[model samples]
Target: MRKALLALAITGVALLGTATPALAHNVLISSDPADSASLATGPAKVTLTFDQYVQDADVNQIAVTGPDGNQWAEGPVTVENNVISAPLRPLGPAGKYTVGYRILSADGHPVSGEIPFTLTKAGTGTPAKVDAAKASGAPAADASATSSPSGSTGIPIWVWIAGAVVLLAIGLTVALRTGREPSQEKTKQ
Candidate 1:
Protein backbone atom coordinates (compact mmCIF):
# COMPACT_ATOMS: atom_id res chain seq x y z
CA MET A 1 0.00 0.00 0.00
CA ARG A 2 2.80 2.42 0.89
CA LYS A 3 4.68 1.67 -2.32
CA ALA A 4 1.54 2.28 -4.35
CA LEU A 5 0.98 5.60 -2.63
CA LEU A 6 4.55 6.66 -3.21
CA ALA A 7 4.29 5.87 -6.93
CA LEU A 8 1.10 7.89 -7.23
CA ALA A 9 2.62 10.87 -5.46
CA ILE A 10 5.73 10.87 -7.68
CA THR A 11 3.59 10.71 -10.80
CA GLY A 12 1.50 13.65 -9.63
CA VAL A 13 4.59 15.76 -8.98
CA ALA A 14 6.09 14.96 -12.39
CA LEU A 15 2.90 15.90 -14.20
CA LEU A 16 2.62 19.19 -12.32
CA GLY A 17 6.19 20.14 -13.16
CA THR A 18 5.72 19.46 -16.87
CA ALA A 19 2.58 21.60 -17.14
CA THR A 20 4.14 24.81 -15.80
CA PRO A 21 5.47 26.13 -19.11
CA ALA A 22 2.24 25.48 -21.01
CA LEU A 23 0.23 27.78 -18.75
CA ALA A 24 2.29 30.91 -19.40
CA HIS A 25 0.54 33.80 -21.21
CA ASN A 26 2.00 35.85 -23.99
CA VAL A 27 3.47 39.30 -23.20
CA LEU A 28 3.59 42.28 -25.57
CA ILE A 29 7.26 42.96 -26.36
CA SER A 30 7.01 45.99 -28.62
CA SER A 31 4.86 47.98 -31.09
CA ASP A 32 5.37 49.69 -34.43
CA PRO A 33 4.52 53.24 -33.33
CA ALA A 34 5.98 52.70 -29.84
CA ASP A 35 3.98 53.72 -26.80
CA SER A 36 3.68 57.48 -26.16
CA ALA A 37 5.68 58.33 -29.30
CA SER A 38 5.21 61.71 -30.97
CA LEU A 39 4.69 61.18 -34.68
CA ALA A 40 4.61 63.88 -37.38
CA THR A 41 2.27 61.66 -39.40
CA GLY A 42 0.40 58.50 -38.49
CA PRO A 43 1.61 55.09 -39.47
CA ALA A 44 -0.09 53.40 -42.44
CA LYS A 45 -0.63 50.38 -40.23
CA VAL A 46 -0.01 49.49 -36.59
CA THR A 47 1.79 46.31 -35.59
CA LEU A 48 2.09 44.72 -32.15
CA THR A 49 4.72 42.12 -31.39
CA PHE A 50 4.53 39.68 -28.54
CA ASP A 51 6.94 37.37 -26.77
CA GLN A 52 4.98 34.34 -27.95
CA TYR A 53 2.86 33.47 -30.95
CA VAL A 54 -0.58 35.10 -31.13
CA GLN A 55 -3.51 32.81 -31.77
CA ASP A 56 -5.22 33.27 -35.10
CA ALA A 57 -8.79 33.96 -34.17
CA ASP A 58 -11.64 36.00 -35.56
CA VAL A 59 -12.16 37.56 -32.15
CA ASN A 60 -8.93 39.57 -32.40
CA GLN A 61 -9.71 43.29 -32.68
CA ILE A 62 -7.72 46.52 -33.01
CA ALA A 63 -9.52 49.83 -32.70
CA VAL A 64 -7.60 53.04 -33.39
CA THR A 65 -9.50 55.92 -31.85
CA GLY A 66 -8.42 59.34 -33.09
CA PRO A 67 -8.22 62.49 -30.97
CA ASP A 68 -11.81 63.24 -32.00
CA GLY A 69 -13.05 59.90 -30.55
CA ASN A 70 -13.64 58.37 -33.99
CA GLN A 71 -12.44 54.95 -35.18
CA TRP A 72 -9.58 54.99 -37.69
CA ALA A 73 -8.73 51.33 -38.14
CA GLU A 74 -9.76 49.93 -41.51
CA GLY A 75 -10.45 46.36 -42.61
CA PRO A 76 -9.71 43.31 -40.42
CA VAL A 77 -6.88 42.59 -37.99
CA THR A 78 -4.21 40.11 -39.13
CA VAL A 79 -1.98 37.74 -37.16
CA GLU A 80 1.30 36.26 -38.35
CA ASN A 81 3.21 34.29 -35.75
CA ASN A 82 4.04 36.67 -32.88
CA VAL A 83 2.97 39.81 -34.74
CA ILE A 84 -0.52 41.29 -35.11
CA SER A 85 -1.29 44.22 -37.33
CA ALA A 86 -4.23 46.32 -38.56
CA PRO A 87 -4.53 48.83 -41.37
CA LEU A 88 -5.44 52.44 -40.63
CA ARG A 89 -7.16 55.16 -42.62
CA PRO A 90 -5.26 58.43 -43.02
CA LEU A 91 -5.04 60.00 -39.56
CA GLY A 92 -6.89 63.28 -38.98
CA PRO A 93 -6.85 66.04 -36.31
CA ALA A 94 -3.58 66.20 -34.41
CA GLY A 95 -3.51 65.19 -30.74
CA LYS A 96 -3.40 61.93 -28.83
CA TYR A 97 -4.58 58.84 -30.75
CA THR A 98 -5.04 55.58 -28.93
CA VAL A 99 -4.62 52.13 -30.44
CA GLY A 100 -6.62 49.66 -28.39
CA TYR A 101 -6.56 45.94 -28.98
CA ARG A 102 -7.95 42.69 -27.57
CA ILE A 103 -6.47 39.43 -28.81
CA LEU A 104 -6.79 35.75 -28.09
CA SER A 105 -3.46 34.60 -26.68
CA ALA A 106 -1.66 31.44 -27.72
CA ASP A 107 -2.78 29.83 -24.48
CA GLY A 108 -6.50 30.39 -25.29
CA HIS A 109 -7.18 33.39 -23.02
CA PRO A 110 -8.01 36.90 -24.15
CA VAL A 111 -5.43 39.66 -23.52
CA SER A 112 -6.09 43.34 -24.09
CA GLY A 113 -4.33 46.72 -23.76
CA GLU A 114 -3.95 50.10 -25.45
CA ILE A 115 -1.11 52.19 -26.94
CA PRO A 116 -1.23 55.95 -27.16
CA PHE A 117 0.69 58.15 -29.62
CA THR A 118 0.61 61.85 -30.34
CA LEU A 119 -0.02 63.12 -33.86
CA THR A 120 2.07 66.31 -34.04
CA LYS A 121 0.47 67.43 -37.30
CA ALA A 122 -2.96 66.85 -38.78
CA GLY A 123 -3.40 64.85 -41.99
CA THR A 124 -6.02 64.56 -44.74
CA GLY A 125 -7.86 61.46 -43.52
CA THR A 126 -11.32 60.48 -42.39
CA PRO A 127 -12.62 58.06 -39.77
CA ALA A 128 -14.13 54.80 -40.92
CA LYS A 129 -17.87 54.69 -40.66
CA VAL A 130 -18.76 53.00 -37.39
CA ASP A 131 -21.41 50.33 -37.55
CA ALA A 132 -24.63 51.30 -35.84
CA ALA A 133 -24.46 48.26 -33.61
CA LYS A 134 -20.90 49.06 -32.46
CA ALA A 135 -21.66 52.75 -31.92
CA SER A 136 -24.63 51.74 -29.78
CA GLY A 137 -22.36 49.63 -27.50
CA ALA A 138 -23.86 46.33 -28.61
CA PRO A 139 -21.50 43.39 -29.09
CA ALA A 140 -20.20 43.28 -32.63
CA ALA A 141 -21.29 40.29 -34.66
CA ASP A 142 -18.85 37.38 -34.97
CA ALA A 143 -16.84 38.22 -38.09
CA SER A 144 -15.67 34.62 -38.69
CA ALA A 145 -18.93 32.76 -38.49
CA THR A 146 -18.34 31.02 -41.80
CA SER A 147 -14.64 30.43 -41.16
CA SER A 148 -13.21 27.41 -39.37
CA PRO A 149 -13.35 27.42 -35.59
CA SER A 150 -10.28 28.69 -33.73
CA GLY A 151 -8.25 26.64 -31.25
CA SER A 152 -4.76 26.11 -29.88
CA THR A 153 -2.15 24.23 -31.91
CA GLY A 154 -1.10 22.22 -28.85
CA ILE A 155 -2.84 19.26 -27.30
CA PRO A 156 -5.39 20.74 -24.89
CA ILE A 157 -4.71 20.91 -21.15
CA TRP A 158 -7.64 18.62 -20.43
CA VAL A 159 -6.01 15.92 -22.46
CA TRP A 160 -2.87 16.26 -20.39
CA ILE A 161 -4.80 15.99 -17.16
CA ALA A 162 -6.62 12.90 -18.35
CA GLY A 163 -3.34 11.35 -19.41
CA ALA A 164 -1.81 12.03 -16.01
CA VAL A 165 -4.72 10.37 -14.26
CA VAL A 166 -4.38 7.28 -16.40
CA LEU A 167 -0.65 7.12 -15.75
CA LEU A 168 -1.11 7.41 -12.01
CA ALA A 169 -3.72 4.69 -12.00
CA ILE A 170 -1.46 2.36 -13.94
CA GLY A 171 1.53 3.08 -11.73
CA LEU A 172 -0.44 2.47 -8.56
CA THR A 173 -1.83 -0.78 -9.88
CA VAL A 174 1.59 -2.09 -10.85
CA ALA A 175 3.15 -1.06 -7.59
CA LEU A 176 0.44 -2.74 -5.53
CA ARG A 177 0.62 -5.98 -7.50
CA THR A 178 4.42 -6.17 -7.27
CA GLY A 179 4.34 -5.43 -3.56
CA ARG A 180 1.93 -8.36 -2.97
CA GLU A 181 3.95 -10.89 -5.01
CA PRO A 182 6.89 -10.92 -2.54
CA SER A 183 4.60 -11.50 0.47
CA GLN A 184 2.83 -14.41 -1.25
CA GLU A 185 6.24 -16.06 -2.02
CA LYS A 186 7.30 -15.81 1.64
CA THR A 187 4.06 -17.50 2.79
CA LYS A 188 4.58 -20.40 0.32
CA GLN A 189 8.18 -20.91 1.47
Candidate 2:
Protein backbone atom coordinates (compact mmCIF):
# COMPACT_ATOMS: atom_id res chain seq x y z
CA MET A 1 0.00 0.00 0.00
CA ARG A 2 2.77 2.41 0.92
CA LYS A 3 4.70 1.59 -2.23
CA ALA A 4 1.61 2.07 -4.35
CA LEU A 5 0.91 5.39 -2.72
CA LEU A 6 4.52 6.44 -3.26
CA ALA A 7 4.32 5.47 -6.91
CA LEU A 8 1.13 7.44 -7.39
CA ALA A 9 2.65 10.47 -5.70
CA ILE A 10 5.73 10.21 -7.85
CA THR A 11 3.64 9.87 -10.95
CA GLY A 12 1.54 12.83 -10.03
CA VAL A 13 4.59 14.95 -9.35
CA ALA A 14 6.19 13.90 -12.60
CA LEU A 15 3.08 14.66 -14.56
CA LEU A 16 2.69 18.03 -12.93
CA GLY A 17 6.38 18.84 -13.06
CA THR A 18 6.92 17.97 -16.68
CA ALA A 19 4.05 20.14 -17.74
CA THR A 20 4.78 21.68 -21.10
CA PRO A 21 1.88 23.69 -22.37
CA ALA A 22 0.84 23.29 -25.95
CA LEU A 23 3.13 25.75 -27.65
CA ALA A 24 2.50 25.48 -31.34
CA HIS A 25 3.70 27.16 -34.51
CA ASN A 26 1.62 29.56 -36.46
CA VAL A 27 0.22 27.68 -39.43
CA LEU A 28 -0.93 29.72 -42.38
CA ILE A 29 -4.65 29.08 -42.49
CA SER A 30 -5.55 31.49 -45.29
CA SER A 31 -4.38 34.49 -47.24
CA ASP A 32 -5.98 37.46 -48.89
CA PRO A 33 -6.05 37.25 -52.69
CA ALA A 34 -5.75 33.50 -52.00
CA ASP A 35 -2.67 31.58 -52.95
CA SER A 36 -2.11 31.49 -56.71
CA ALA A 37 -5.36 33.34 -57.31
CA SER A 38 -5.40 35.09 -60.65
CA LEU A 39 -6.42 38.62 -59.82
CA ALA A 40 -7.35 41.12 -62.49
CA THR A 41 -5.73 43.90 -60.46
CA GLY A 42 -3.29 44.29 -57.61
CA PRO A 43 -4.35 44.40 -54.05
CA ALA A 44 -3.65 47.37 -51.78
CA LYS A 45 -1.81 45.07 -49.43
CA VAL A 46 -0.76 41.47 -49.13
CA THR A 47 -2.14 39.70 -46.07
CA LEU A 48 -1.37 36.30 -44.61
CA THR A 49 -3.50 34.76 -41.90
CA PHE A 50 -2.31 32.01 -39.63
CA ASP A 51 -3.82 29.35 -37.42
CA GLN A 52 -2.09 30.86 -34.43
CA TYR A 53 -0.95 34.39 -33.78
CA VAL A 54 2.49 35.38 -34.96
CA GLN A 55 4.66 37.43 -32.74
CA ASP A 56 4.81 40.98 -34.01
CA ALA A 57 7.09 42.45 -31.40
CA ASP A 58 10.09 41.33 -33.35
CA VAL A 59 10.10 42.27 -37.00
CA ASN A 60 8.69 39.55 -39.28
CA GLN A 61 10.52 39.70 -42.57
CA ILE A 62 8.70 38.67 -45.75
CA ALA A 63 10.00 38.74 -49.30
CA VAL A 64 7.75 39.45 -52.24
CA THR A 65 9.09 38.10 -55.49
CA GLY A 66 7.38 39.66 -58.51
CA PRO A 67 7.13 38.27 -62.01
CA ASP A 68 9.99 40.49 -62.98
CA GLY A 69 11.98 39.19 -60.01
CA ASN A 70 11.46 42.57 -58.34
CA GLN A 71 10.41 43.00 -54.74
CA TRP A 72 6.95 44.52 -54.19
CA ALA A 73 6.37 44.37 -50.44
CA GLU A 74 7.41 47.58 -48.70
CA GLY A 75 8.48 48.25 -45.17
CA PRO A 76 8.37 46.10 -42.05
CA VAL A 77 5.68 43.50 -41.51
CA THR A 78 2.55 44.37 -39.56
CA VAL A 79 0.50 41.84 -37.64
CA GLU A 80 -3.07 42.14 -36.40
CA ASN A 81 -4.94 39.23 -34.90
CA ASN A 82 -3.39 36.36 -36.81
CA VAL A 83 -2.76 38.38 -39.95
CA ILE A 84 0.62 39.51 -41.11
CA SER A 85 0.62 41.99 -43.94
CA ALA A 86 2.60 44.52 -45.86
CA PRO A 87 1.69 47.35 -48.19
CA LEU A 88 1.81 46.84 -51.93
CA ARG A 89 2.27 49.89 -54.06
CA PRO A 90 0.86 48.48 -57.35
CA LEU A 91 0.93 45.53 -59.60
CA GLY A 92 3.48 45.08 -62.32
CA PRO A 93 3.09 43.40 -65.73
CA ALA A 94 0.47 40.70 -65.16
CA GLY A 95 2.15 37.57 -63.92
CA LYS A 96 2.78 35.48 -60.87
CA TYR A 97 4.20 36.83 -57.63
CA THR A 98 5.46 34.83 -54.66
CA VAL A 99 5.51 36.05 -51.09
CA GLY A 100 7.83 34.30 -48.69
CA TYR A 101 7.53 34.98 -45.01
CA ARG A 102 9.52 33.96 -41.91
CA ILE A 103 7.97 35.06 -38.66
CA LEU A 104 8.40 34.26 -35.00
CA SER A 105 5.46 32.23 -33.82
CA ALA A 106 3.91 32.75 -30.44
CA ASP A 107 6.15 29.88 -29.40
CA GLY A 108 9.18 32.03 -30.20
CA HIS A 109 10.24 29.65 -32.93
CA PRO A 110 10.54 30.98 -36.47
CA VAL A 111 7.97 29.78 -38.98
CA SER A 112 8.30 30.41 -42.69
CA GLY A 113 6.69 29.43 -45.98
CA GLU A 114 6.07 30.69 -49.48
CA ILE A 115 2.77 31.41 -51.22
CA PRO A 116 2.18 32.68 -54.75
CA PHE A 117 -0.61 34.43 -56.58
CA THR A 118 -1.00 35.49 -60.19
CA LEU A 119 -2.29 38.78 -61.57
CA THR A 120 -4.58 38.46 -64.56
CA LYS A 121 -4.17 42.08 -65.60
CA ALA A 122 -1.29 44.48 -65.55
CA GLY A 123 -1.23 47.30 -63.05
CA THR A 124 0.48 50.59 -63.90
CA GLY A 125 2.10 51.41 -60.58
CA THR A 126 5.75 51.29 -59.71
CA PRO A 127 6.90 49.13 -56.82
CA ALA A 128 6.68 51.95 -54.39
CA LYS A 129 9.89 52.54 -52.51
CA VAL A 130 9.81 51.67 -48.83
CA ASP A 131 9.21 54.81 -46.83
CA ALA A 132 11.93 55.57 -44.33
CA ALA A 133 9.48 55.70 -41.44
CA LYS A 134 7.56 52.52 -42.28
CA ALA A 135 10.71 50.93 -43.57
CA SER A 136 12.54 51.42 -40.32
CA GLY A 137 9.45 50.76 -38.20
CA ALA A 138 7.25 47.74 -37.81
CA PRO A 139 3.52 48.06 -38.22
CA ALA A 140 1.62 49.67 -35.38
CA ALA A 141 -0.34 46.48 -35.02
CA ASP A 142 -0.98 43.98 -32.25
CA ALA A 143 2.36 43.60 -30.54
CA SER A 144 1.56 40.39 -28.72
CA ALA A 145 -0.32 38.49 -31.46
CA THR A 146 2.61 38.68 -33.82
CA SER A 147 5.12 37.04 -31.53
CA SER A 148 5.45 33.62 -29.94
CA PRO A 149 2.10 32.26 -28.83
CA SER A 150 3.75 31.00 -25.66
CA GLY A 151 4.20 33.68 -23.10
CA SER A 152 7.86 34.58 -22.56
CA THR A 153 10.01 32.40 -20.30
CA GLY A 154 11.11 32.31 -16.65
CA ILE A 155 9.32 30.15 -14.13
CA PRO A 156 5.65 30.96 -14.00
CA ILE A 157 4.01 31.52 -10.63
CA TRP A 158 1.96 28.36 -11.02
CA VAL A 159 5.13 26.34 -11.17
CA TRP A 160 6.17 27.50 -7.75
CA ILE A 161 2.73 26.71 -6.36
CA ALA A 162 2.78 23.29 -7.93
CA GLY A 163 6.12 22.52 -6.41
CA ALA A 164 4.87 23.57 -3.01
CA VAL A 165 1.74 21.53 -3.34
CA VAL A 166 3.60 18.41 -4.34
CA LEU A 167 6.02 18.76 -1.47
CA LEU A 168 3.20 19.36 0.95
CA ALA A 169 1.28 16.36 -0.27
CA ILE A 170 4.34 14.14 0.00
CA GLY A 171 5.14 15.38 3.51
CA LEU A 172 1.59 14.90 4.70
CA THR A 173 1.34 11.44 3.25
CA VAL A 174 4.62 10.39 4.85
CA ALA A 175 3.67 11.84 8.22
CA LEU A 176 0.28 10.19 8.24
CA ARG A 177 1.57 6.80 7.20
CA THR A 178 4.74 6.70 9.34
CA GLY A 179 3.74 8.62 12.44
CA ARG A 180 0.60 6.64 13.36
CA GLU A 181 -0.13 3.73 15.80
CA PRO A 182 1.55 5.51 18.73
CA SER A 183 -1.22 4.34 21.07
CA GLN A 184 -1.04 0.76 19.80
CA GLU A 185 2.71 0.56 20.34
CA LYS A 186 2.41 2.01 23.84
CA THR A 187 -0.25 -0.53 24.80
CA LYS A 188 1.90 -3.40 23.51
CA GLN A 189 4.87 -2.22 25.65
Candidate 3:
Protein backbone atom coordinates (compact mmCIF):
# COMPACT_ATOMS: atom_id res chain seq x y z
CA MET A 1 0.00 0.00 0.00
CA ARG A 2 2.80 2.41 0.93
CA LYS A 3 4.73 1.55 -2.22
CA ALA A 4 1.63 2.11 -4.33
CA LEU A 5 1.00 5.50 -2.69
CA LEU A 6 4.63 6.55 -3.24
CA ALA A 7 4.51 5.53 -6.88
CA LEU A 8 1.32 7.49 -7.46
CA ALA A 9 2.85 10.56 -5.81
CA ILE A 10 5.92 10.33 -8.04
CA THR A 11 3.75 10.06 -11.13
CA GLY A 12 1.76 13.12 -10.12
CA VAL A 13 4.94 15.18 -9.65
CA ALA A 14 6.29 14.07 -13.02
CA LEU A 15 3.12 15.11 -14.76
CA LEU A 16 3.20 18.52 -13.11
CA GLY A 17 6.77 19.07 -14.26
CA THR A 18 5.96 18.20 -17.86
CA ALA A 19 2.89 20.44 -17.93
CA THR A 20 4.67 23.50 -16.49
CA PRO A 21 6.88 24.16 -19.50
CA ALA A 22 3.97 23.89 -21.95
CA LEU A 23 2.03 26.68 -20.26
CA ALA A 24 3.71 29.57 -22.08
CA HIS A 25 2.15 30.57 -25.44
CA ASN A 26 3.04 32.97 -28.20
CA VAL A 27 1.68 36.51 -27.74
CA LEU A 28 1.06 39.28 -30.25
CA ILE A 29 3.58 42.08 -29.74
CA SER A 30 2.63 44.48 -32.53
CA SER A 31 1.30 44.88 -36.06
CA ASP A 32 1.98 46.96 -39.14
CA PRO A 33 -1.15 49.14 -39.32
CA ALA A 34 -1.20 49.34 -35.51
CA ASP A 35 -4.52 48.41 -33.97
CA SER A 36 -7.18 51.15 -34.34
CA ALA A 37 -4.81 53.51 -36.20
CA SER A 38 -6.23 55.88 -38.78
CA LEU A 39 -4.31 55.69 -42.04
CA ALA A 40 -4.48 57.96 -45.12
CA THR A 41 -3.54 55.06 -47.41
CA GLY A 42 -4.02 51.32 -47.29
CA PRO A 43 -0.98 49.29 -46.26
CA ALA A 44 0.54 47.09 -48.96
CA LYS A 45 0.60 44.20 -46.56
CA VAL A 46 -0.59 43.21 -43.11
CA THR A 47 2.04 42.01 -40.66
CA LEU A 48 1.76 40.47 -37.22
CA THR A 49 4.64 40.16 -34.80
CA PHE A 50 4.64 37.73 -31.92
CA ASP A 51 6.75 37.60 -28.78
CA GLN A 52 7.82 34.00 -29.50
CA TYR A 53 8.60 32.06 -32.64
CA VAL A 54 5.48 30.98 -34.53
CA GLN A 55 4.97 27.74 -36.41
CA ASP A 56 5.29 28.18 -40.17
CA ALA A 57 2.37 26.05 -41.23
CA ASP A 58 0.11 26.19 -44.25
CA VAL A 59 -2.75 26.81 -41.82
CA ASN A 60 -1.69 30.41 -41.20
CA GLN A 61 -4.21 32.90 -42.57
CA ILE A 62 -4.95 36.65 -42.74
CA ALA A 63 -8.12 38.36 -43.90
CA VAL A 64 -8.67 42.06 -44.36
CA THR A 65 -12.31 43.12 -44.30
CA GLY A 66 -13.10 46.49 -45.84
CA PRO A 67 -16.09 48.74 -45.15
CA ASP A 68 -18.18 46.88 -47.75
CA GLY A 69 -17.50 43.59 -45.96
CA ASN A 70 -15.42 42.41 -48.87
CA GLN A 71 -12.15 40.56 -48.32
CA TRP A 72 -9.15 42.73 -49.25
CA ALA A 73 -6.19 40.68 -48.15
CA GLU A 74 -4.32 39.03 -51.01
CA GLY A 75 -1.89 36.15 -51.38
CA PRO A 76 -0.99 33.52 -48.82
CA VAL A 77 0.25 34.38 -45.33
CA THR A 78 4.00 34.02 -44.91
CA VAL A 79 5.92 33.53 -41.69
CA GLU A 80 9.53 34.48 -41.03
CA ASN A 81 11.42 35.14 -37.82
CA ASN A 82 8.32 35.25 -35.59
CA VAL A 83 6.49 37.50 -38.08
CA ILE A 84 3.43 36.59 -40.15
CA SER A 85 2.38 38.79 -43.06
CA ALA A 86 -0.01 38.80 -45.98
CA PRO A 87 -0.14 41.05 -49.04
CA LEU A 88 -3.15 43.26 -49.82
CA ARG A 89 -4.86 43.74 -53.20
CA PRO A 90 -5.13 47.51 -52.75
CA LEU A 91 -7.96 48.52 -50.43
CA GLY A 92 -11.26 50.13 -51.50
CA PRO A 93 -14.39 51.58 -49.85
CA ALA A 94 -12.24 53.11 -47.13
CA GLY A 95 -13.87 53.28 -43.73
CA LYS A 96 -12.88 50.67 -41.21
CA TYR A 97 -10.76 47.71 -42.24
CA THR A 98 -10.59 44.75 -39.94
CA VAL A 99 -7.49 42.58 -40.05
CA GLY A 100 -8.12 39.07 -38.81
CA TYR A 101 -5.27 36.61 -38.47
CA ARG A 102 -4.82 33.06 -37.30
CA ILE A 103 -1.31 31.77 -36.84
CA LEU A 104 0.07 28.60 -35.38
CA SER A 105 2.20 29.07 -32.27
CA ALA A 106 5.53 27.29 -31.89
CA ASP A 107 3.95 24.68 -29.67
CA GLY A 108 1.42 23.71 -32.38
CA HIS A 109 -1.49 25.79 -31.09
CA PRO A 110 -3.51 28.33 -33.09
CA VAL A 111 -3.76 31.96 -31.94
CA SER A 112 -6.08 34.45 -33.59
CA GLY A 113 -7.44 38.00 -33.20
CA GLU A 114 -8.76 41.00 -35.04
CA ILE A 115 -7.28 44.48 -35.48
CA PRO A 116 -9.42 47.35 -36.74
CA PHE A 117 -7.92 50.30 -38.60
CA THR A 118 -9.78 53.21 -40.12
CA LEU A 119 -8.97 54.36 -43.67
CA THR A 120 -9.24 58.14 -43.65
CA LYS A 121 -9.61 58.35 -47.43
CA ALA A 122 -11.16 56.07 -50.02
CA GLY A 123 -8.92 54.16 -52.42
CA THR A 124 -9.32 53.71 -56.18
CA GLY A 125 -8.87 49.92 -56.04
CA THR A 126 -11.78 47.50 -56.08
CA PRO A 127 -12.46 44.90 -53.38
CA ALA A 128 -11.93 41.23 -54.10
CA LYS A 129 -15.19 39.49 -54.95
CA VAL A 130 -15.85 36.33 -53.00
CA ASP A 131 -18.69 33.83 -53.35
CA ALA A 132 -21.21 34.03 -50.54
CA ALA A 133 -21.11 30.27 -49.95
CA LYS A 134 -17.33 30.04 -49.98
CA ALA A 135 -16.82 33.16 -47.91
CA SER A 136 -18.95 31.75 -45.13
CA GLY A 137 -17.30 28.35 -45.43
CA ALA A 138 -15.68 26.42 -42.62
CA PRO A 139 -11.92 26.70 -43.10
CA ALA A 140 -11.24 30.39 -42.60
CA ALA A 141 -13.80 30.93 -39.84
CA ASP A 142 -12.97 27.77 -37.87
CA ALA A 143 -9.43 28.84 -37.04
CA SER A 144 -10.49 31.78 -34.91
CA ALA A 145 -13.24 29.83 -33.22
CA THR A 146 -10.87 27.00 -32.27
CA SER A 147 -8.20 29.20 -30.77
CA SER A 148 -7.85 29.37 -27.00
CA PRO A 149 -7.18 32.57 -25.04
CA SER A 150 -3.71 34.19 -24.89
CA GLY A 151 -2.31 32.68 -21.70
CA SER A 152 -3.50 29.15 -22.43
CA THR A 153 -0.94 27.03 -24.25
CA GLY A 154 -3.26 24.92 -26.42
CA ILE A 155 -5.27 22.10 -24.88
CA PRO A 156 -7.58 22.63 -21.92
CA ILE A 157 -6.26 22.21 -18.38
CA TRP A 158 -8.63 19.35 -17.75
CA VAL A 159 -6.98 17.35 -20.52
CA TRP A 160 -3.67 17.52 -18.69
CA ILE A 161 -5.29 16.64 -15.42
CA ALA A 162 -7.05 13.65 -16.94
CA GLY A 163 -3.77 12.43 -18.45
CA ALA A 164 -2.04 12.71 -15.12
CA VAL A 165 -4.80 10.78 -13.44
CA VAL A 166 -4.42 7.93 -15.92
CA LEU A 167 -0.67 7.80 -15.31
CA LEU A 168 -1.16 7.74 -11.56
CA ALA A 169 -3.68 4.94 -11.85
CA ILE A 170 -1.25 2.86 -13.90
CA GLY A 171 1.60 3.50 -11.50
CA LEU A 172 -0.49 2.56 -8.49
CA THR A 173 -1.66 -0.64 -10.16
CA VAL A 174 1.86 -1.72 -11.06
CA ALA A 175 3.28 -0.86 -7.64
CA LEU A 176 0.53 -2.71 -5.79
CA ARG A 177 0.77 -5.82 -7.95
CA THR A 178 4.57 -6.03 -7.60
CA GLY A 179 4.40 -5.42 -3.87
CA ARG A 180 1.71 -8.08 -3.40
CA GLU A 181 3.67 -10.71 -5.35
CA PRO A 182 6.74 -10.35 -3.10
CA SER A 183 4.61 -10.57 0.04
CA GLN A 184 2.88 -13.68 -1.30
CA GLU A 185 6.24 -15.31 -2.03
CA LYS A 186 7.57 -14.53 1.46
CA THR A 187 4.45 -16.00 3.05
CA LYS A 188 4.80 -19.17 1.02
CA GLN A 189 8.38 -19.70 2.23
* Global lDDT of model 1: 0.77
Q: Candidate 1 — worst ten consecutive residues by lDDT sum?
A: 138-147
Order of candidate numbers by TM-score, starting with the best: 1, 3, 2
Model 3 C-alpha lDDT per residue in residues 1-189, reported as the tens digit of each score: 777777777877878886874566678999999999999999999999999888877667788888877788766678997998888888787698888887777766677888889999988887666763234321242336656555444576677788877877887777877567566788999
TM-score of 2: 0.61
lDDT of each candidate versus the true structure: 0.77, 0.68, 0.76
**Residue 37 lDDT, candidate 1, scale 0-100:** 98
Per candidate, the number of residue pairs that clash is: 0, 12, 0
Per-residue lDDT over 1-189 for candidate 1, one digit per residue giving the tens place of the 0 to 100 score: 777777778877877876776677788899989999999998999899999899998777777888888888887789999999988889999999887776777877666777889999999998888783254221122222322223434456687788777877887777777567676789998
Misplaced by over 4 Å in model 1 are 1-6, 132-171, 178-181, 184-189
